[model samples]
Target: MDSDELREVLQEAGLSPYQSKAYVALLELGTASARELVEASDVPDPRIYDVVRSLEDRGYVETYEQDTMRARAHSPADVLDDLQNRASRFEQAADEIEDRWEQPELDRHAASIVKRFETVVDRARLFIQEAENQIQLSASIEQYEQLRGVLADALDRGVYIQLSIYTNPDDDVELPAEEQLAATTTEARHRPIPSPFVALIDRQKACFGPHEDALNEYGVLVDDRMHEYIFHWYYSSCLWEICDEIYSSRNDEPPIEYVDVREFIRDVEPMLLDDLSVGVRVVGKDVSTGEERELEGEVADVFYEGDDYRGTREIPLAQLAGRASVTVATDEGEFTVGGEGAMLEDVEAMRLTITSASE
Candidate 1:
């Protein structure tokens, strides 16, 4: 690089303009008297001595009497070593200062803004890895691809994930199949609209922003539990409610285990002991003619046979005809309608699909 450019680099490394100019001049001239430096560099004659003195103190130059007073610039390697040593010391001090710093308390609703897209990506990774119990997020396929590694690690740690994601209908991006089968992924839904980059972790923290490439891209991180709850509510009530659950696997097989509510009552009953509702698909079979039939109507019930779990689910109305009994587990995704009925099942294979009973 030219002397002018090298001088600019030196200035960037914390040298004063006068010092950088004088050093570059000396390096170029090999050795220079006071007048020679003033002529070769932008440093004024009156300030040349002071600049050279400062350079000598910083170990970037050496001054000595050789007929006339002279200053010789240190080799570039030596100068850079000096700059690096100072930088290291500054970093060490900074680490010590941060160790002794106390974080100020902020309002629960307060959010801190990050102005860089790179920083936003970094903060998202931090939140995903720090999550303990659950992570709820909405993203475009591109956004999730950027975060796939950190998210996979979170899943490996047993964090439950509820994702509302969509592929860019116009783009060629495809969702990875392995991610669809992750054990920690409790539910994966397809959102039609584009999703702002956002995530809530453990109901304790949230980060949100526009797409990464948007003009003046920025993000905000809210650390309040109350704010976290609000983000989660918005995700569930607004985004999640409208998304379609991914019911079929890559091989077209249903990922959820479907069992006859009556035949598997002993095994299924214990699974439903929790207060949370379970999804089930109901089917009807004939006892006499060995014919199987399905119907549609609004009728549902949960009963126990001396603690043995027994449930009857009817398909949605449109085909109400048979005695509906066996309930197959289904999800509350867009594909499933909520009600007690048998009319809907008759339209298909007399099959009622439900959310995974194991979740």
Candidate 2:
């Protein structure tokens, strides 16, 4: 636009201040001797020669040894091509930044830190859709609504859904009724206070975000079982356990199913202690081989770290934090079954159903 701005553009394009001035002066002069360039550019006469040589090296100008050393600006064709290429690169880079912002790439076996909490919730849809046997979720009422349809689809597929929806206690939010929630989730809870949005799917993948009102907005996407384990506990103790169940479509009678070992232990531990026979069928992965397997048997024994604890509503998540397993007596033999991603057991259970109960 202006002479000063044009000079600035040239300087920003890798020309030194003096080179920019000298080149601009040469272009206006059409063809100039060293003395003429010094007069037009206002560059110190002593530095003009070296500046012209630098411009010549960059193909911005050409110099010839004449009666008094003549110099002239180059055709500018190559310079225009370079600028166009740079513009294209900048445009491509901008698009890539937007794409990555919208869908942050997550590592399959590690955590990926993402910029926005919304990104975590949005990406979690696919994980929720792929849920095989279990899903643990905590959401704001809005977030819950956003995921309600997918959760309903998963429920129709017989995936165990545990959801906790929260809002500020002061806000008189019209919460969903039990009848409405039962269609989407197996169990749902409500928190009168704010909580982070968390989704743990099939004990293998997790999406975690800070409270929506947090000053810094960030989230974590985890595909690691160990990372998922930590997120699972967080969801359990803070979000799910204390909250009162608002809606449940759980089958309260025989043939009750549990996707979590801790829950399985809680319900069936009482039956086992009562000397009632609880028959179970477990679908899970083999601990040693990581292959999917289904095992059916009668409950043999229940084991955990603490002797005083028999899994019940009163038992805290911390109590269930240590080793907990179900030993089943099949026709083949008695084998131990643990929770999802269970490392120290015979099988990592995805779902365990009490197929029969006998007095």
The C-alpha lDDT values of all candidates are 0.56, 0.80
On residues 282-358, what C-alpha lDDT tens digit does candidate 1 reach at each position?
44343333255443322133333232112323222222212333333223212222122223332212234443433
Clashes of each: 32, 0
Q: Please, what are the lDDT tens digits per residue for candidate 2 over residues 210-294?
A: 8878999877778888999888888888898899888887688868888888888878878876779999999888999989989
Cα error of candidate 2 at position 42, Å:
37
TM-score of every prediction relative to native: 0.43, 0.69
Off by over 4 Å in 1: 1-109, 179-184, 212-216, 247-359
Candidate 2 global lDDT: 0.80
10 residues in a row with least lDDT, candidate 1 = 333-342
